[model samples]
Target: MTEKSMLVVSAHSADFVWRAGGAIALHKKNGYRVKVVCLSFGERGESAKLWRKGPDMTIEKVKAARREEALAAAENLGAECEFFDLGDYPLRVSDEALLRLVDVYRDVQPAFVLSHSQKDPYNFDHPLAMHVAQEARIIAQAEGHNPGQKIVGAPPVYAFEPHQTEQCEWIPNTFLDITEVWDVKRRAIECMAGQEHLWEYYTRVAQQRGVQAKRNIGITVKRDIQYAEGYMRLTPAVVGDLS
Candidate 1:
């Protein structure tokens, strides 16, 4: 049988680490081949600390640092990562870039896809990333987009948690219990040195999500969930049974 795979489309280098790190680590532990596509290094907008490192900080330098951090995080989570090098702080995805993402969809043939929320008032780039991710999925399923290449199936799409769930209007319909891989996720989260301030915040988010996940699973399940990742599933779940 073919190995299962999952794809994560991130607007910035560290987005994947903060939002879906638990999912990445847990799914990898479950034998899924994980792939992360970072649309940009978030040099201008997200790298505030790197910029404060004196007057000699350049965009290239910041980007390099972000790249290293993202790579380390992906490595810790056992996932392969690809960088688009597209500048952030108003991420622009050209027709060429969109097609490139389509190619990734065909190549990975992901069992499911993860990306940002559809709406983020604080970060416009976040919504744009999700827009492109869904657009690419549609194009990848089109036989005429790249004739003769294998087309991808109808893989479910999920929007990972945003920083401000209420503001972004993102509600989690799916919760993944990531207690077993919480340590691995934390290790990956630590790799993001530039965003140290958010480390504890996301950790708390995981703990809160875990409580919600446990409540949803009921008290009779007898499973202890200490950490979890929330996702707003964008597509319908086609299941054989409703159990």
Candidate 2:
């Protein structure tokens, strides 16, 4: 049997941990190999705690710290993490970087893809990441685009929740019940020491999503869901059965 796999394209090193740690952990527990690609280390924009430590903190130092944290977080969730090191004050994705991402899609042949929301006015990087992810997915699916490499399967793309869901205009069409793996997710969250302030915020987000999941499924099931992650499906799902 072929092994199941997932690909997550995050704009920042710690974005995956914040948004999809539960999903990653749950999928890993279910026998899926998860691969995370962080387009940028978020050293410039997201490393407030590290920057606060010293006035002369170099970009390399910030990158190193964030990379270490990201690796630790990925480890806690049983996923492999890779860095693009694209740099991020305004997170730009060059043509080379886009091609590299397309290469990853072909190589991994992911069963599904996760990425940032298409609209995030507060953080421009999030939207740009989504754009690149979508383009890469398209290019990867075209057989003629890269003649030597095998064309990838058409995997559904899911946009994980942003920090400010209301401002981002994100709607959750998929709610993942991650109650069993909440501990794994929390451990992953704790790994991101630079962003300690967000720990409680994400935990609460999970709990609220769990409540939404419970309501969406109805009250008759008697589920005691304590944590969950929500996603917006960006592609049409092809299913064998309606149920």
In terms of lDDT, which candidate is strongest? 1
lDDT of each: 0.96, 0.93
Clashing pairs in 2: none
Angstrom error of the Cα, residue 178, model 2: value is 0.6
lDDT of 2 at 220: 93
**Per-prediction tally of clashes:** 0, 0
What are the per-model C-alpha RMSD values against the true structure?
Answer: 0.7, 1.1
Q: Which stretches of candidate 2 lie above 4 Å from their native place?
A: 240-243
RMSD of 2: 1.1
In the range 1-243, model 2's lDDT, one tens digit per residue, is 988999999999999998999989999999998999999999989999999998788889989999999999999999999899988878888999999999999888899999999999899999999999999999998878879889888899999999888899999999999999999999999999999999999999999999999999998998898899999998998789998
Instruction: Tell how far residue 34 is off in model 1, in angstroms.
Output: 0.7
